[model samples]
Target: MNWKNTTRQTLGTTVLCLAALAATAASAATQQMVSVKGSTLNMRSGPGTHTEVLWELKRGYPLKVLARKGRWLQVIDFEKDRGWVARSLTGSTPHHVVKSRVANMRSGPGTQHRIVGKVEYGEVLRTREKRADWVRVERDSGKIGWIAKRLLWGW
Candidate 1:
Protein backbone atom coordinates (compact mmCIF):
# COMPACT_ATOMS: atom_id res chain seq x y z
CA MET A 1 0.00 0.00 0.00
CA ASN A 2 1.13 3.63 -0.57
CA TRP A 3 1.40 4.72 3.07
CA LYS A 4 3.37 7.92 2.33
CA ASN A 5 0.87 8.97 -0.33
CA THR A 6 -2.04 8.53 2.09
CA THR A 7 -0.29 10.61 4.76
CA ARG A 8 0.44 13.42 2.29
CA GLN A 9 -3.17 13.53 1.15
CA THR A 10 -4.41 13.70 4.76
CA LEU A 11 -2.03 16.55 5.55
CA GLY A 12 -3.24 18.53 2.53
CA THR A 13 -6.84 18.06 3.56
CA THR A 14 -6.09 19.23 7.09
CA VAL A 15 -4.48 22.42 5.80
CA LEU A 16 -7.48 23.18 3.60
CA CYS A 17 -9.90 22.63 6.46
CA LEU A 18 -7.93 24.96 8.70
CA ALA A 19 -7.90 27.63 6.04
CA ALA A 20 -11.66 27.44 5.63
CA LEU A 21 -12.17 27.72 9.38
CA ALA A 22 -9.92 30.79 9.49
CA ALA A 23 -11.95 32.43 6.78
CA THR A 24 -15.18 31.69 8.59
CA ALA A 25 -13.84 33.23 11.77
CA ALA A 26 -12.74 36.33 9.90
CA SER A 27 -16.19 36.78 8.41
CA ALA A 28 -17.71 36.38 11.86
CA ALA A 29 -15.97 39.58 12.87
CA THR A 30 -19.04 41.63 12.07
CA GLN A 31 -20.49 44.66 13.76
CA GLN A 32 -23.92 44.28 15.33
CA MET A 33 -26.28 46.38 17.43
CA VAL A 34 -28.34 45.69 20.53
CA SER A 35 -31.94 45.58 19.37
CA VAL A 36 -33.82 48.60 20.70
CA LYS A 37 -36.69 47.24 22.72
CA GLY A 38 -36.78 50.10 25.21
CA SER A 39 -34.31 48.14 27.32
CA THR A 40 -30.66 47.28 27.72
CA LEU A 41 -28.86 44.15 26.57
CA ASN A 42 -27.01 42.28 29.27
CA MET A 43 -23.51 41.23 28.43
CA ARG A 44 -22.56 38.29 30.54
CA SER A 45 -19.34 36.61 31.54
CA GLY A 46 -20.48 33.41 29.91
CA PRO A 47 -22.90 32.27 27.21
CA GLY A 48 -25.84 31.60 29.48
CA THR A 49 -28.12 33.84 31.50
CA HIS A 50 -26.93 31.99 34.58
CA THR A 51 -23.58 33.70 34.23
CA GLU A 52 -22.68 36.98 35.83
CA VAL A 53 -23.66 40.13 34.00
CA LEU A 54 -20.59 42.10 33.09
CA TRP A 55 -22.32 45.08 31.58
CA GLU A 56 -25.61 46.38 30.24
CA LEU A 57 -25.44 47.68 26.69
CA LYS A 58 -28.04 50.09 25.46
CA ARG A 59 -29.82 50.01 22.13
CA GLY A 60 -27.67 51.20 19.20
CA TYR A 61 -24.45 50.30 20.97
CA PRO A 62 -22.04 48.81 18.45
CA LEU A 63 -20.29 45.54 19.23
CA LYS A 64 -17.82 43.45 17.29
CA VAL A 65 -18.52 39.75 17.27
CA LEU A 66 -15.37 37.86 18.08
CA ALA A 67 -16.79 34.36 18.47
CA ARG A 68 -20.08 32.53 18.77
CA LYS A 69 -21.53 29.76 20.86
CA GLY A 70 -24.98 28.28 20.89
CA ARG A 71 -27.30 31.27 20.75
CA TRP A 72 -24.65 33.58 22.21
CA LEU A 73 -22.02 35.81 20.73
CA GLN A 74 -18.70 36.73 22.25
CA VAL A 75 -18.50 40.47 21.65
CA ILE A 76 -16.16 43.35 22.21
CA ASP A 77 -16.95 47.03 22.37
CA PHE A 78 -15.05 50.16 21.30
CA GLU A 79 -13.53 50.28 24.76
CA LYS A 80 -12.15 46.77 24.16
CA ASP A 81 -14.35 45.31 26.83
CA ARG A 82 -15.36 41.73 26.07
CA GLY A 83 -18.49 39.86 27.02
CA TRP A 84 -21.10 37.46 25.77
CA VAL A 85 -24.52 38.52 24.48
CA ALA A 86 -27.55 36.62 23.31
CA ARG A 87 -27.51 36.51 19.52
CA SER A 88 -31.25 37.09 19.33
CA LEU A 89 -30.86 40.49 20.99
CA THR A 90 -28.52 41.80 18.32
CA GLY A 91 -29.18 43.35 14.92
CA SER A 92 -27.20 44.21 11.78
CA THR A 93 -27.78 47.97 11.90
CA PRO A 94 -24.76 50.26 11.80
CA HIS A 95 -24.23 52.53 14.78
CA HIS A 96 -21.62 54.35 16.85
CA VAL A 97 -21.14 55.20 20.50
CA VAL A 98 -19.58 58.29 21.99
CA LYS A 99 -16.31 57.26 23.60
CA SER A 100 -15.03 60.66 24.53
CA ARG A 101 -16.17 62.87 27.34
CA VAL A 102 -18.14 64.99 24.93
CA ALA A 103 -18.54 65.04 21.16
CA ASN A 104 -19.53 68.19 19.32
CA MET A 105 -22.12 67.76 16.60
CA ARG A 106 -21.74 70.26 13.80
CA SER A 107 -23.88 71.20 10.84
CA GLY A 108 -21.14 70.35 8.37
CA PRO A 109 -18.30 67.89 8.22
CA GLY A 110 -15.63 70.24 9.50
CA THR A 111 -15.00 72.32 12.59
CA GLN A 112 -15.75 75.49 10.61
CA HIS A 113 -19.39 74.44 10.50
CA ARG A 114 -21.90 75.61 13.07
CA ILE A 115 -22.31 73.56 16.23
CA VAL A 116 -25.65 71.86 16.05
CA GLY A 117 -25.63 69.99 19.34
CA LYS A 118 -23.61 67.92 21.79
CA VAL A 119 -23.46 64.22 22.71
CA GLU A 120 -22.04 62.86 25.92
CA TYR A 121 -20.13 59.73 26.73
CA GLY A 122 -21.90 56.36 26.35
CA GLU A 123 -24.51 57.90 24.07
CA VAL A 124 -25.25 55.91 20.90
CA LEU A 125 -25.89 57.43 17.48
CA ARG A 126 -26.88 55.91 14.17
CA THR A 127 -24.28 56.17 11.42
CA ARG A 128 -25.46 58.35 8.56
CA GLU A 129 -22.44 59.24 6.47
CA LYS A 130 -18.72 59.83 6.51
CA ARG A 131 -16.76 62.79 5.13
CA ALA A 132 -13.04 62.82 5.81
CA ASP A 133 -12.51 62.33 9.55
CA TRP A 134 -16.00 63.55 10.32
CA VAL A 135 -18.97 61.19 10.60
CA ARG A 136 -22.53 62.32 10.06
CA VAL A 137 -24.70 60.88 12.86
CA GLU A 138 -28.36 60.84 13.76
CA ARG A 139 -29.76 60.97 17.24
CA ASP A 140 -32.82 59.15 18.59
CA SER A 141 -34.85 62.31 18.19
CA GLY A 142 -34.26 62.24 14.38
CA LYS A 143 -31.72 65.08 14.51
CA ILE A 144 -28.79 64.77 12.17
CA GLY A 145 -25.30 66.25 12.57
CA TRP A 146 -21.63 65.54 12.08
CA ILE A 147 -19.01 64.52 14.61
CA ALA A 148 -15.30 63.86 14.41
CA LYS A 149 -14.70 60.15 13.98
CA ARG A 150 -11.82 60.17 16.44
CA LEU A 151 -14.23 61.02 19.27
CA LEU A 152 -16.47 58.04 18.68
CA TRP A 153 -16.27 54.29 18.21
CA GLY A 154 -17.88 51.57 16.08
CA TRP A 155 -18.90 51.80 12.39
Candidate 2:
Protein backbone atom coordinates (compact mmCIF):
# COMPACT_ATOMS: atom_id res chain seq x y z
CA MET A 1 0.00 0.00 0.00
CA ASN A 2 1.16 3.57 -0.75
CA TRP A 3 0.97 5.34 2.66
CA LYS A 4 2.01 8.74 1.30
CA ASN A 5 -0.71 8.64 -1.38
CA THR A 6 -3.39 7.87 1.24
CA THR A 7 -2.23 10.71 3.51
CA ARG A 8 -2.24 13.20 0.61
CA GLN A 9 -5.76 12.24 -0.44
CA THR A 10 -7.05 12.54 3.14
CA LEU A 11 -5.50 16.00 3.55
CA GLY A 12 -7.05 17.24 0.29
CA THR A 13 -10.48 16.01 1.30
CA THR A 14 -10.19 17.69 4.72
CA VAL A 15 -9.22 20.99 3.11
CA LEU A 16 -12.24 20.83 0.79
CA CYS A 17 -14.58 20.07 3.69
CA LEU A 18 -13.26 23.02 5.68
CA ALA A 19 -13.77 25.34 2.69
CA ALA A 20 -17.37 24.22 2.28
CA LEU A 21 -18.08 24.72 5.98
CA ALA A 22 -16.72 28.26 5.79
CA ALA A 23 -18.93 29.13 2.83
CA THR A 24 -22.03 27.85 4.64
CA ALA A 25 -21.19 29.86 7.75
CA ALA A 26 -20.70 32.99 5.68
CA SER A 27 -24.12 32.62 4.07
CA ALA A 28 -25.80 32.05 7.44
CA ALA A 29 -24.95 35.48 8.90
CA THR A 30 -28.18 36.65 10.56
CA GLN A 31 -29.97 39.97 10.30
CA GLN A 32 -31.30 41.18 13.67
CA MET A 33 -32.67 44.13 15.64
CA VAL A 34 -30.68 46.11 18.20
CA SER A 35 -32.48 45.99 21.53
CA VAL A 36 -30.33 48.09 23.84
CA LYS A 37 -32.38 46.88 26.87
CA GLY A 38 -32.82 50.32 28.52
CA SER A 39 -29.38 51.97 28.77
CA THR A 40 -28.16 53.36 25.44
CA LEU A 41 -26.12 50.92 23.37
CA ASN A 42 -22.73 52.27 22.51
CA MET A 43 -21.20 51.36 19.18
CA ARG A 44 -17.45 51.29 19.33
CA SER A 45 -14.62 51.32 16.83
CA GLY A 46 -13.59 47.92 18.07
CA PRO A 47 -15.02 44.93 19.94
CA GLY A 48 -14.62 46.24 23.51
CA THR A 49 -15.88 49.06 25.72
CA HIS A 50 -12.33 50.38 25.90
CA THR A 51 -12.50 51.08 22.19
CA GLU A 52 -13.54 54.51 20.95
CA VAL A 53 -17.26 55.14 20.92
CA LEU A 54 -18.39 55.72 17.35
CA TRP A 55 -21.99 56.38 18.20
CA GLU A 56 -24.96 55.44 20.38
CA LEU A 57 -28.07 53.45 19.46
CA LYS A 58 -31.47 53.09 21.03
CA ARG A 59 -33.50 49.97 21.55
CA GLY A 60 -35.20 48.38 18.52
CA TYR A 61 -32.62 49.73 16.06
CA PRO A 62 -32.11 47.34 13.14
CA LEU A 63 -28.73 46.04 12.03
CA LYS A 64 -27.22 43.38 9.82
CA VAL A 65 -24.61 41.38 11.63
CA LEU A 66 -21.50 40.64 9.60
CA ALA A 67 -19.49 38.87 12.25
CA ARG A 68 -19.20 38.16 15.97
CA LYS A 69 -16.39 37.86 18.48
CA GLY A 70 -16.79 36.99 22.13
CA ARG A 71 -19.43 39.46 23.39
CA TRP A 72 -19.14 41.88 20.45
CA LEU A 73 -20.80 41.93 17.04
CA GLN A 74 -19.79 43.78 13.88
CA VAL A 75 -22.95 45.42 12.50
CA ILE A 76 -24.14 47.65 9.69
CA ASP A 77 -27.21 49.88 9.74
CA PHE A 78 -29.62 51.31 7.14
CA GLU A 79 -27.38 54.31 6.49
CA LYS A 80 -24.37 52.04 5.84
CA ASP A 81 -22.89 52.90 9.23
CA ARG A 82 -20.63 50.12 10.43
CA GLY A 83 -19.43 49.51 13.98
CA TRP A 84 -19.07 47.03 16.75
CA VAL A 85 -21.87 46.53 19.26
CA ALA A 86 -22.30 44.32 22.28
CA ARG A 87 -23.89 40.99 21.35
CA SER A 88 -26.26 41.28 24.32
CA LEU A 89 -27.91 44.31 22.71
CA THR A 90 -29.31 42.49 19.69
CA GLY A 91 -32.10 40.02 18.92
CA SER A 92 -33.70 38.05 16.08
CA THR A 93 -36.67 40.38 15.63
CA PRO A 94 -37.16 41.24 11.95
CA HIS A 95 -36.92 44.84 10.74
CA HIS A 96 -36.70 46.68 7.39
CA VAL A 97 -34.92 49.68 5.87
CA VAL A 98 -35.90 51.76 2.86
CA LYS A 99 -33.81 50.89 -0.18
CA SER A 100 -35.37 53.20 -2.72
CA ARG A 101 -34.55 56.88 -3.02
CA VAL A 102 -38.04 57.66 -1.80
CA ALA A 103 -40.59 55.07 -0.71
CA ASN A 104 -44.21 56.08 -1.02
CA MET A 105 -46.06 55.27 2.17
CA ARG A 106 -49.65 54.37 1.51
CA SER A 107 -52.56 54.36 3.93
CA GLY A 108 -53.20 50.71 3.20
CA PRO A 109 -51.30 47.74 1.84
CA GLY A 110 -51.67 48.65 -1.82
CA THR A 111 -51.01 51.46 -4.25
CA GLN A 112 -54.72 52.03 -4.65
CA HIS A 113 -54.82 53.35 -1.11
CA ARG A 114 -54.22 57.00 -0.28
CA ILE A 115 -50.62 58.20 -0.34
CA VAL A 116 -50.05 58.94 3.28
CA GLY A 117 -46.42 60.06 3.20
CA LYS A 118 -42.91 59.31 2.00
CA VAL A 119 -39.72 58.00 3.53
CA GLU A 120 -36.26 58.81 2.25
CA TYR A 121 -33.63 56.26 1.48
CA GLY A 122 -31.95 54.66 4.49
CA GLU A 123 -34.95 55.34 6.73
CA VAL A 124 -35.46 52.53 9.21
CA LEU A 125 -38.89 51.10 9.97
CA ARG A 126 -40.07 48.65 12.55
CA THR A 127 -42.01 45.73 11.19
CA ARG A 128 -45.54 45.80 12.60
CA GLU A 129 -47.40 43.50 10.21
CA LYS A 130 -47.09 41.90 6.81
CA ARG A 131 -49.79 41.26 4.18
CA ALA A 132 -48.86 39.58 0.94
CA ASP A 133 -46.15 41.73 -0.73
CA TRP A 134 -46.67 44.77 1.47
CA VAL A 135 -45.40 45.33 5.02
CA ARG A 136 -46.98 47.56 7.64
CA VAL A 137 -44.33 49.65 9.39
CA GLU A 138 -43.91 52.44 11.90
CA ARG A 139 -41.20 55.09 11.65
CA ASP A 140 -39.20 56.62 14.49
CA SER A 141 -41.61 59.53 14.49
CA GLY A 142 -44.59 57.15 15.02
CA LYS A 143 -45.92 57.47 11.47
CA ILE A 144 -47.52 54.24 10.28
CA GLY A 145 -47.79 53.23 6.63
CA TRP A 146 -47.39 50.42 4.13
CA ILE A 147 -44.51 49.95 1.71
CA ALA A 148 -43.77 47.44 -1.00
CA LYS A 149 -41.63 44.73 0.47
CA ARG A 150 -39.33 44.79 -2.53
CA LEU A 151 -38.41 48.42 -1.88
CA LEU A 152 -36.72 47.61 1.39
CA TRP A 153 -34.06 45.31 2.78
CA GLY A 154 -34.47 42.63 5.53
CA TRP A 155 -38.06 41.97 4.40
Candidate 3:
Protein backbone atom coordinates (compact mmCIF):
# COMPACT_ATOMS: atom_id res chain seq x y z
CA MET A 1 0.00 0.00 0.00
CA ASN A 2 1.14 3.58 -0.70
CA TRP A 3 2.29 5.47 2.47
CA LYS A 4 0.10 8.51 1.67
CA ASN A 5 -3.05 6.34 1.25
CA THR A 6 -2.29 4.52 4.55
CA THR A 7 -1.89 7.83 6.42
CA ARG A 8 -5.31 9.14 5.22
CA GLN A 9 -7.10 5.91 6.25
CA THR A 10 -5.55 6.04 9.75
CA LEU A 11 -6.53 9.72 10.19
CA GLY A 12 -10.13 8.97 9.10
CA THR A 13 -10.41 6.11 11.58
CA THR A 14 -9.09 8.31 14.44
CA VAL A 15 -11.61 11.07 13.65
CA LEU A 16 -14.51 8.58 13.71
CA CYS A 17 -13.36 7.21 17.08
CA LEU A 18 -13.12 10.69 18.57
CA ALA A 19 -16.60 11.59 17.31
CA ALA A 20 -18.09 8.51 19.02
CA LEU A 21 -16.35 9.35 22.32
CA ALA A 22 -17.65 12.93 22.25
CA ALA A 23 -21.22 11.76 21.69
CA THR A 24 -21.03 9.39 24.66
CA ALA A 25 -19.67 12.15 26.90
CA ALA A 26 -22.45 14.50 25.87
CA SER A 27 -25.08 11.88 26.70
CA ALA A 28 -23.71 11.43 30.21
CA ALA A 29 -23.65 15.17 31.02
CA THR A 30 -27.43 15.58 31.44
CA GLN A 31 -28.40 16.61 34.98
CA GLN A 32 -30.39 14.24 37.26
CA MET A 33 -32.89 15.24 39.96
CA VAL A 34 -31.52 14.55 43.45
CA SER A 35 -34.86 15.47 45.05
CA VAL A 36 -38.14 17.27 44.54
CA LYS A 37 -39.23 20.45 46.28
CA GLY A 38 -42.47 22.47 46.77
CA SER A 39 -45.92 20.98 47.39
CA THR A 40 -46.23 18.88 44.26
CA LEU A 41 -45.38 18.57 40.58
CA ASN A 42 -47.78 17.42 37.91
CA MET A 43 -46.91 14.50 35.67
CA ARG A 44 -48.37 14.48 32.20
CA SER A 45 -49.07 11.66 29.77
CA GLY A 46 -47.14 13.26 26.92
CA PRO A 47 -44.63 16.03 26.18
CA GLY A 48 -45.37 19.61 25.03
CA THR A 49 -48.52 21.73 24.52
CA HIS A 50 -51.12 18.99 24.65
CA THR A 51 -51.00 16.18 27.21
CA GLU A 52 -53.18 14.60 29.87
CA VAL A 53 -52.31 14.95 33.56
CA LEU A 54 -51.24 11.65 35.09
CA TRP A 55 -50.28 12.22 38.70
CA GLU A 56 -48.98 14.64 41.35
CA LEU A 57 -45.58 14.48 43.10
CA LYS A 58 -44.82 15.82 46.56
CA ARG A 59 -41.58 17.18 48.04
CA GLY A 60 -38.51 14.93 48.37
CA TYR A 61 -39.79 13.30 45.21
CA PRO A 62 -37.18 11.39 43.19
CA LEU A 63 -37.12 10.72 39.47
CA LYS A 64 -34.88 9.36 36.71
CA VAL A 65 -34.88 10.75 33.22
CA LEU A 66 -35.51 8.15 30.53
CA ALA A 67 -35.24 10.55 27.61
CA ARG A 68 -35.64 14.16 26.55
CA LYS A 69 -37.36 15.70 23.58
CA GLY A 70 -36.88 19.44 23.26
CA ARG A 71 -38.10 21.24 26.43
CA TRP A 72 -39.90 18.18 27.85
CA LEU A 73 -38.43 15.23 29.75
CA GLN A 74 -39.66 11.67 30.11
CA VAL A 75 -39.03 10.38 33.63
CA ILE A 76 -39.82 7.65 36.13
CA ASP A 77 -40.82 8.90 39.56
CA PHE A 78 -39.77 7.34 42.89
CA GLU A 79 -42.89 5.16 42.74
CA LYS A 80 -41.62 3.99 39.34
CA ASP A 81 -44.48 5.79 37.63
CA ARG A 82 -43.44 6.97 34.18
CA GLY A 83 -44.51 10.29 32.72
CA TRP A 84 -43.40 13.57 31.21
CA VAL A 85 -42.88 17.09 32.57
CA ALA A 86 -41.19 20.37 31.87
CA ARG A 87 -37.42 20.08 32.43
CA SER A 88 -37.21 23.34 34.40
CA LEU A 89 -39.46 22.13 37.27
CA THR A 90 -37.18 19.54 38.90
CA GLY A 91 -34.38 19.81 41.50
CA SER A 92 -31.40 17.86 42.87
CA THR A 93 -31.52 17.67 46.70
CA PRO A 94 -30.99 14.53 48.81
CA HIS A 95 -33.87 12.81 50.68
CA HIS A 96 -34.44 10.17 53.40
CA VAL A 97 -37.24 8.20 55.10
CA VAL A 98 -38.63 6.86 58.33
CA LYS A 99 -37.83 3.23 59.12
CA SER A 100 -40.20 2.30 61.94
CA ARG A 101 -43.89 1.64 62.35
CA VAL A 102 -46.15 4.28 63.93
CA ALA A 103 -43.34 6.81 64.40
CA ASN A 104 -44.45 9.81 66.42
CA MET A 105 -43.23 13.19 65.16
CA ARG A 106 -43.86 15.83 67.73
CA SER A 107 -43.73 19.60 67.99
CA GLY A 108 -40.90 19.30 70.52
CA PRO A 109 -38.31 16.74 71.60
CA GLY A 110 -39.79 15.62 74.92
CA THR A 111 -42.80 13.30 75.19
CA GLN A 112 -44.65 16.21 76.84
CA HIS A 113 -44.92 18.03 73.54
CA ARG A 114 -47.97 17.66 71.28
CA ILE A 115 -47.94 15.07 68.54
CA VAL A 116 -47.75 16.94 65.28
CA GLY A 117 -47.65 14.02 62.85
CA LYS A 118 -47.56 10.24 62.70
CA VAL A 119 -45.08 8.72 60.25
CA GLU A 120 -45.78 5.20 59.13
CA TYR A 121 -43.25 2.53 58.31
CA GLY A 122 -41.38 3.19 55.06
CA GLU A 123 -42.64 6.75 54.93
CA VAL A 124 -40.09 9.20 53.50
CA LEU A 125 -38.70 11.92 55.80
CA ARG A 126 -36.36 14.80 55.05
CA THR A 127 -33.70 14.91 57.79
CA ARG A 128 -32.33 18.00 59.49
CA GLU A 129 -30.67 17.13 62.87
CA LYS A 130 -30.91 15.22 66.13
CA ARG A 131 -31.39 16.38 69.69
CA ALA A 132 -31.39 13.47 72.14
CA ASP A 133 -34.18 11.08 71.04
CA TRP A 134 -35.60 13.71 68.66
CA VAL A 135 -34.74 13.97 64.98
CA ARG A 136 -35.53 17.19 63.23
CA VAL A 137 -37.31 16.80 59.90
CA GLU A 138 -38.31 19.06 57.04
CA ARG A 139 -41.54 18.38 55.22
CA ASP A 140 -41.99 18.57 51.49
CA SER A 141 -43.58 22.01 51.80
CA GLY A 142 -40.68 23.19 54.04
CA LYS A 143 -42.37 22.43 57.36
CA ILE A 144 -39.70 22.11 60.06
CA GLY A 145 -40.40 19.76 62.93
CA TRP A 146 -39.03 16.91 65.05
CA ILE A 147 -39.51 13.15 65.22
CA ALA A 148 -38.31 10.35 67.46
CA LYS A 149 -34.88 8.87 66.71
CA ARG A 150 -36.31 5.36 66.60
CA LEU A 151 -38.49 6.40 63.67
CA LEU A 152 -35.93 7.24 61.00
CA TRP A 153 -33.46 5.33 58.80
CA GLY A 154 -30.78 7.88 57.84
CA TRP A 155 -30.16 9.05 61.42
- Which one wins on TM-score? 1
Clashing pairs in 2: none
lDDT of 3 by residue, 18-106 (tens): 99999887676443543455667778999964788898767666566778888888887545578987777766555556656577778
Per-residue CA lDDT of model 1 for 1-155, tens digit only, reads 49999999999999999999998767756544443333579999999999999998888888888788999988888889999999888887778899999989999999999999999998999999987899999999999999999998877
Span of ten consecutive residues with least summed lDDT in model 1: 30-39
Best by lDDT: 1
Can you list the residue pairs that collide in candidate 3? Answer: 34-92
Worst 10 residues of 3 by lDDT: 29-38
The better-scoring model by TM-score among 1 and 2 is 1
Model 2: lDDT equals: 0.81
Query: Order of candidates by TM-score, top first?
Result: 1, 2, 3
Identify the superior model by lDDT, candidate 1 or candidate 2: 1
Off by over 4 Å in 1: 1-38
Whole-model lDDT values for every prediction: 0.87, 0.81, 0.72
Q: How accurate is candidate 1 locally (lDDT)?
A: 0.87
TM-score of 2: 0.69
Global lDDT of model 3: 0.72
lDDT of 3 at 81: 77
